[model samples]
Structures are given as C-alpha cells and as structure tokens.
Target: MKLYDHSVTVSSKRLNLFLKEIGVTDIERVEVNVREGGNLAQSYQDKSVNGKVPLLELDDGTYLSETVAISRYFDEITPNDLNLFGASTLERAKVEMWNRIVEIDGIQNAFQAFRNLSGIYADRENCVEAWGEEAKHRVELFLPKLDKQLGQSKYVATDNYTIADISAYIFVFVAVNALKVDVFETSQNIKRWFDDVSSRPALQN
Candidate 1:
C-alpha cells in the first residue's frame, strides 16, 4: 500500500498519527506536494479525481481518498489491533459523531479563516474576506462550548483516546496557528486537554 502524503496538510498529519497509534508501519509513503501543484498533475489526478493528499493505494489498484475513510480502512484491516474508531458499537458512534462535529464546526471554519484572511489559496479558489471573518468568528464562538465539553470528559468520545481527539486536536492546532485564535490562552479546559493529549507519544511521532 502507498500513502500519497502531504507533510503539512491536516489529513496527512491525522493519518500518520493514526498509523503510529495502530502500530501499522508496512504501508509506504509517496509525497505529493500540493503547494507545488503536484496533485494537479494529470497522472496523479487521473487516479485521485479530488486531487487530495492522504490518499491510499490498495494492493489491487484501488485508490482510496479522504482521511477518515482511509484511516477506517486501515483500522478495519487490523481488527486484532487497537481500534482508534472505538471498541464497541455505541462507542464507535460516539467517536464518529464527535469527529464529524469537530470537522464541521472547528476545522472547517479554521481553514475558511486561513484561506480567506491569509489569501494563501486565493489563486486556487475564491477568498471572500467577509465570509472569512465570519468563519473565524464562528469558530471563536464554538471554542467555549468545546472547552465546556472537555472540562467534563478526559477524552472527546470515550474514556479512552479515540479519533475524535485527533480531529479536535487538529482543530485546536489550526485555531492557534492558522486562524490565529487564542485557544490555549483563553480556554483553560482546552489547554489542559491539549496538554494531556500532547503528552501522548503518538502525537510526537
């Protein structure tokens, strides 16, 4: 299996962190520099219609895209190993729910703020500053609610760490770095949760 990777993208980071957590190291990595328009190349785009990183090439020439789907595939293949999605049916649903929430509310808005305000991807797509401002404001509003949730639970979905943590951690990272939102400084619960999650060796790798 080949993992088409982009070092800086959030999906790449998520997939890499997940693989380490699941102890799957057999898959080889192939770099796709999106910033250089490598994903736009006809050869690569032919296989990956979406032209996205963190794509996986299965043994029989099946191309898998999307971070969540690719990670789930790997998790399913190694049923005996630790499941990052969850261990039980209900827990799996909780993990999926929280991950989707983080993706839609936190991660999406942060990316919107960055793309519009920073004009980083203005050439590739429309960068509406007004909408970007609203997006940033929306994430800022959502942070307090997230912090409240973190105050109650040690992890996002279940008692143990799961995929929701990965997704939310990415959101916090994007909030601070790209969106320039004061997440850790303002939200103590989130700060504590971030510190706790940061201590994991999986994140460092």
Candidate 2:
C-alpha cells in the first residue's frame, strides 16, 4: 500500500499520527506538495476526486480518501491490534460521537479560520476575513466544552487513547499554530490532556 501524503496539512498529520500509533510502518509514502498544486494536478485528481492529500492506495489499486475513512480502514484491517476505534458497541458509539464533535466543533472551525486568515492557502482557495474571524470565535467558544469533556476522561472517548484523541490533538495543533491562540492558558484540562498526548512516542515523530 502507498499513502499520498502532505506533512503540513492537519488532516494528513492526523492520519500519519494514527498510522504511527497503530505501528504501521511497512507502507510506502508518496509526498504531495499542495503548495505546488500537486494535489490539484490531473493525475492526483484522477486518483482522488476531491484532489486532497493523504490518499491511500491499496495493493489492488483501490484508492481511499478522507482521514476518518482511512483510519477506519486501518482499524478494520487490524481489528485486534490497538483498538483505536473501540472494542465494544458502546465504546464505538462514544468514540464516534467524540470524533464527530472534535471534527465539527474543533478541527473544521480551526481549519476554516486558518484557510481564511493565512496567506499560505491564498492560492488554493479564496480567503475571507469575516469568515476567518467567525471560525476563530467558534473555536474559542467550543474550547471550554472540549475541556470539560477531557476533564471527565483520561482520553477523549474512553480510558484508552483512541482516534478521537488524535482528532482533538490535530485541532489543538492548528489552534495554536494557525489561529495563534493560547489554548493552554484557557483550559487546564486540555493542557493536561495535550501534554500527555504530545509525550507519546508516536506523536514525537
């Protein structure tokens, strides 16, 4: 299998981190330079209709797009390994719930704010300052809820670290690096959870 990757993007990073956490190292990696329009090129577009990075090409030449879908594929292939999704029905539901929350409230908002505010994405998409400001505000409003959730559990979904934690970590990464927000100061629970997640050897890479 081969992974078409762009290291700088949050979605790609989340996928990469998930792969690492699951101890997947045998797959070949092909880097895509989004800044150079590599992802939008005709060849890549043919492989991924969305023209996005982090496309996983299976040995049979099947292509998988979307970070969550890719992660789910990995989980399905290695069901008894790390159990990143969940081991039980209730655990799976909770994991999916938290993952959706992090995606909708955290990652999506933070990414929108970054895309609209940063000059780096100007060539890729039109930037709107008003939209950026609104997205940033939405992220800020959602942080406390995230903090409260983290306060209740060691990880996002359950006692074990899972895909939800990966999603939240990437969102926090974008919040700090792209939005230029100091989230650590506003939420001690998030800060504690983030510190623990960051110390993982898989994330250090």
Candidate 3:
C-alpha cells in the first residue's frame, strides 16, 4: 500500500498517526507539495484529481480521499477484531457520533477560522474574508459544549481510545498547535485528555 500526503499538512498527521497505531511497516508514502493551481508535485500530482493531500492508493490502484476515511481505512486494515473501532454495534455508533461532532464542531470551525483569518486559501474557491470572523465565533461557541461533553468522560466515545478520539484529537491538536486556541485554558479536562493523546508513541512518529 502507498500513502500520498503532504509532509506538513495536518490531514497527513491523521493518516500517519493511524499508521503508527497499527504498526503498519509495509506501507510506503509519497509526500509532496500540491500547488494551489495545476502545478502539483510529482508524488500525488498524477493520482490526485482534486489536488488534496493524504490520498491513499491501494495495491490495485484504488484512490481514497478524505482524512477521516483514510484514517479509518488504515485503522481497520488489520484483520483482527480488536481495534480502535468499537467491538460492538452500539459502541461503533457512539464512536461515529463523536466523530461527526468533532468534524463539524471542531475541525470545521478551525478550518474556517484559518481560511478566513489567515487568507491561506483565499485565492481558491470561496474566499470571502468575512468567514474568518464567523469561524472564530463558531469555535468559541463550541468550547463550552466541548466542556460539557468532557465533564463526564475521559475519551470521546466508548469510554476508551477509539476512532472518535482520533477523529477529534487530530483536529483539536492542530488547532491548539497551529491556530493557538489555548484549549488548556478553555477546558482543563480537554487539555489533560489532549496531553495524554499527544504522549502516545504513535503520534511521536
């Protein structure tokens, strides 16, 4: 299997973290800088149609896009029933639920904040500068909700480190590190949970 990704992009971190979790030693990676326009780097330029990073290429040439999809694929690649995904249907559903919340509430807000404020992708599709302010508001709005959720749980779903944790943590980690959200100040439990996840050996790789 081969993974096509950007070296520094946050999305790539998700795939890399999962690969580390599963101890996938046989996979090869092609890291590149996909340009904003048509000028894409050599590694994924040919395979990428949307010009996105973290594209996974199966041995048969099937291309997989989206960070969450790719991370889940890698997490479940092994045949063992014991994995980050829940062991039962209800457990899996809960993980999925938290994953959805994280995607919408955490990741979306952070991306909106960056795209609107930093003007990073302003040259691309919708580039309204006003969205940045809205994104900041969205993120701030979700902090208290996150505090509520963390008030009763250590991990996001299944009461353990499941895909939900990975889904949420990857985005929140990026926000704290890149966006400087000061998550520690907003919620102490969130800070503690994040620190625990950050200390995992899979992330260090």
Candidate 4:
C-alpha cells in the first residue's frame, strides 16, 4: 500500500497518527506538498478526485480518500491486529459518535478558523474574516464540552483508546501547534488527557 501524504496538514497528521497507533509501519509513503500545489495537479487529482492529501492506494490499485475512510480501511484490513475502532458493537457506536462530534464540532471549526485567518491559504480559497472569527468562537465553545467528556472518561469513547481519541488528539494538536491556541490550558482534564495521550510510544514515531 502507498499513502500519499503531506506532513503539515491536520488531516494528514491524523491519518499518520492513526497508522502509527495501529502499528501499521509497512506501507510506503509518497509525499505530496500541498502548500506547493502538488495536490492540485492533474496527476494527484486523478488519484484523489477531491485533490486532497493522505490518500491511500491499495496494492490492488484501489485508491481511498478522506481521513476517516482511510483510517477505517486500515482497521478493516487488519482486524486481527490492534483494534482502534472498537472491540464490541456498542463500543463501535460510541467511538463513531464521539469521532463525529470531534470532527464536526471541534476539528472542522478549528480548520475553518485557520483557513480563513492564515495567509498561507489566502490564494487557495476565499476567506471571510467574519467567518473565521465565528469559527474560532465555536472552537472555544467546543473545548469545554470536550473537557467535560474527558472528565468522565479516560478516553473519548470509552476506557480504552479508540479512533475517537486519535481524532480528538489530532484536533487539539492542530489547535495548539498550528493555530497557536493553548487548548490544553483551557481545562485541567484536557491537559491531563493530552499528556497521557502524548506519552504513548506510537506518537513518538
């Protein structure tokens, strides 16, 4: 398998982190420099219709896009390996639920704010300052909710680590590292959770 990736973007980071956490290290990586318009090229667009990074190409010539789908595909192909999705039916539902919340309410808002405010994306798309401000505010609102969830559980979906935790961790990492927001400082529970997740050996890779 070949993973067409860009190291800097949030979605690419999430997929890379997921792969590491699941102990899948054999896949080859093809770097796509999105900032340089590598993803916008005809060659890349042919493989990924949406012109996005973190696309997974199977050995059988099947291409997969979308971070969530690629992560799930890894889980599906390696069912007997580490289970990042869930171990039980109910657990899978919970993981999916929390993953959706983190993606929609947390990561999406953060991305919107970054895309609109960052000069790096100025030529990539139309950015509205008002929309960026609104999106930043929404991210602030979502942090408290995530903190509350973390206070009740060690992990996002359950006691065990799952894809939901990976999703949330990447969002927080992007908020702090990319957006320059001190998200872990917003809540003690989140800070603790972040520290715990960060200590995982998989992330060191």
Q: Which candidate is the best by TM-score?
A: 2
Report how far off residue 25 is in candidate 2 (Å): 0.8
Model 4 spans with C-alpha error above 4 angstroms: 79-81
lDDT of 3 by residue, 1-205 (tens): 7787776777777767766677775778775655453225454557766668878888999888887788778766665544577778988888788888888988888877777777766556576677877876777777777767777888877567876777778777767776777778978878878888888887774
Predict model 3's lDDT versus the native: 0.74
For candidate 4, what is the TM-score? Answer: 0.94
Candidate 4, pairs of clashing residues: none
lDDT of each: 0.86, 0.90, 0.74, 0.87
For lDDT, the strongest prediction is 2
Pairs that collide in candidate 2 are: none
Model 2 TM-score is: 0.95
Per-residue lDDT of 62 in model 2: 97
Every model's TM-score? 0.94, 0.95, 0.87, 0.94
Candidate 1 per-residue C-alpha lDDT over 40-130 given as tens digits, one digit per residue, 9 for 90 to 100: 7889998885788879998899999888898889888875546678889998898888899888998889888888999876657888999
- Alpha carbon lDDT at 117, candidate 2: 78
Candidate 4 lDDT score relative to the true structure: 0.87
Candidate that beats the other on TM-score, 1 or 3, i.e. the better one: 1
Separate clash counts for every candidate: 0, 0, 0, 0
